[model samples]
Target: MRVVLSCLLMLLFVPDWMGEPRLPLMGKRAVVRAAPIALDAAHPARSRVGALVWLGGVRLTSPDRAFGGFSALHVARGHRVTLLSDGGNIVQFTLGPDWRPRAIAFGDLPAGPGTGWAKVDRDSESMGVDPRDGSVVAGFENSNMLWRYTPDLRRALGAAAPRAMAGWPGNEGAESFTFLPRAGWGGGAIAIGEQAPWPGGTGRAAFRFTGDPVREPNRGYRFSYIPPARSDPSDMTVLPDGRLIVLNRRFTLPFTFTNTLVVIDRGAIRPGAVVRGREIATLAPPLVHENFEGIAATREGGRTILWLVSDDNQSVLQRSLLLKFRLDAPGTPGSARP
Candidate 1:
């Protein structure tokens, strides 16, 4: 009786990030329910948080069991959004005129390394999308691979296993990914490990690929990045101005998650460079709190529009939240390093 009770208690106290791995969800198309949420629950009129202006927010829910666990997000023209879960599931939806979710669809990766029998085989953690052609490059965690896919993400094109990522801790590998528009940086892609510290320093390992990471895995270089204190990088996206918006997440005791947004200047990235961007915004209690793992930015009417998606880990204790914020200027304050 004591052993059984001990096991139950251990399960109850497990951290939010310790949620059980989920299988792929290939559900049918249906509208997802969204509840408009205030940025500041206690003060509904408040909208600003740190350097961001909360434009809108929503708590997304669905009867489908696979509706949550979104880890990476992409917002395209006409507010069409595609969310990729770490479990290799994909959810595509459009925002109605009123910002409600519509035309929702779910899909599982057509093919991945190994038999899709185990979660580790398909643990896709981050992705980068080509702006011109809509092609996608997915970064798998446990396998430490980069896989390219069609615009619809229904078919695999090619895949590669970069040598630098071979040593990244399974769960912490390739959590931050983006395609660099900066020609000076090879105009290829950048991927940063979530928590694997560099061999010689405290920074995490980051890599720059000269072309399709899957096609030219050996044509680039590696660097290091110092994220916010005690935070792990989850996702990142490039801006029209050649800057990067990185989302870092933290989980605390008693099941709490907070996110920090950092912006790195285009000039700071280079071969073997150790970069730490400036802090832009902080998302936490009193204002908001969730496991915000994905961040995407785009230019709209000359203003930078930022979108964040949370990974609920498919736990009833948490929520799948989608938020929008406006960053008035691209040039942010001083850098942060610790």
Candidate 2:
């Protein structure tokens, strides 16, 4: 009886948002602030050796306490962005001509397959949108589930937990998700684990689910993605020519963040095959880096644009960052990397 009483008291003292998903009461519009930031505070004019050129960046803040923890992002055509928070909230905003955000909206995700109590239960870490119909698919970590929504991201369409994700760690289930737009390879959605080490000493586990994974869960192939040492895959997006660009991140003690952008060939990704990417660029200290957790790519008239967003972890010590770059190379697949 004494042990039971003690456990009950401990639970009472714990924070209400510990593991379950929590959201602010804000309906559609929310007040968010974006402050201009430089690629390198010390040397703002510095540039990397590869084809990527830093365009601009901003640090985002909000009055709402539940505003941070943005882990996944999808950038649409009109400078509009949809961000997924670790707290199970979706924030949508559009950038104006000056790169400042406007028309911000905040809302909670429709309840799905999870405890629905703690943030971890709704810890959505990766997201991708179908190019054909603009349908959105979000990957949740704790439950190892994928939730699909309409183009507007208001209603839940369907969800599923693939059998291939059976042994994935609850905390690191799905952090890298993207949709391949090329029709040559039978375009589909790909999901990869963040910290889930690959079996047989290869690397991280990855799955390519052909067709809608929520409907045809078993129609997919498994593979491996090998990133740089000590780093984990954060987000992935496809290039114009069928290749994939994956973002990796590593954090060191005392608050140091490092980010790497890798480009992989679609031909190298297949069942039982291990795909390794060529390091295209590295973002570290002295060149403006943060806990960048999201990545998206788009093709402009003559160049490829890359957009990245950071997860602030709702900590005062960190800031939500959005960085943009222009890859000055041909849009053909695999040409930008090599």
Candidate 3:
């Protein structure tokens, strides 16, 4: 009886003497904000829509094997959505009635080393398509080279064509690009590069080039002070009002988030003038994902709708999230475009 009582007393008091206390079984919950007005509407052609679409919280082995790391996407002339994988492979998928990828076709990357220290080894990052000719211009990450492919995409299949542009200064790896029209310069393309090991910190830079791949002076300027700290400007799109919207990734140790969307005023930027920018909105991370890299904007009805996508980097801790948002024009002074 004495032994039994001693053992029971020890079991009851030993936990209290321990340095760490036992944790309670408290359940954790995620908070979901109320749906914005624009996203609440049901019509497919509503003025605007915004929602977060969970893209399989993990990488799909079969799909990724067929597509590689799909980092860039564009809507082609035929309404076909072309996805460019980081492994130098392009996949074309037909948009379904619900605006999802379907009926996929595989394609190839550019040939030959266009620029940088060594031959281009296929680090396709972002791409821009010529609306007039259907040709594709792809930017490689490490090589800092721009490659122009024929509309047929066959010329780039072989390793013989000369590089479209070469020997760009600084570690400006081309990441995002778009086409803009100018009066005397004709229709030119604007390419944006991500942060690299350069003199200045990683910031956004813009370049203007003629449609011809052989043209010299691919004339352009760099916007030195638009992006935020540790921001990896990944993708860009033009707003209806002729402004530029840049999506940036906020990278920190062990965490990546889509924290800011910058808007560059149309009048502030010129052919050679450096312009400042302002952050219009800050996006919330999807559940537990990071590395939001893709951005697209389109006008529905009369409102501007922004779309975003995350790069999972093939890590189990990350996921690809397709999110949408409607731009709410801010009335405050700081919200004004720079």
lDDT of each: 0.84, 0.82, 0.54
Which tens-of-lDDT digit does each residue in 217-274 have in candidate 2? 6788899888898999999999877789999999998899999888888889888788
| lDDT tens per residue, model 3, 1-338 | 99999867867877443333332111222111111222122432332212222222122223333333556766543446565655565555554444445565565653635322122356667766655667777767666665668765547522212132243333446666665544433566666667542244334555656544324334444444357766767877666567777777777665656556778876666654554567765554333335766666656557666656556664667654445555755463333332
RMSD of each: 6.6, 4.0, 15.3
- Best model number under lDDT: 1
| Residue-wise C-alpha lDDT for candidate 1, range 1-338, written one tens digit per residue | 99999768867874432445446476785558899999989999987877788789899888777678888899998899999887888888898768777778888888876556567878888888965477899899888888989999999999999998888888888998998774545478999999987787678999888776888886787888998999989999987777888899889998888799888987788888999988878888877889998889877788888999999988999889999987857445421211
Q: Which pairs clash in model 3?
A: none
In candidate 3, how many Å is residue 279 off? 1.6
At residue 185, give the lDDT of candidate 2: 66
| Comparison by TM-score, 1 against 3, better one | 1
* Regions more than 4 Å wrong, model 1: 1-24, 182-186, 330-338
Clash tally for model 3: 0
Q: Against the hidden reference, what TM-scores do the models get?
A: 0.89, 0.89, 0.66
C-alpha RMSD (angstroms) for model 1: 6.6
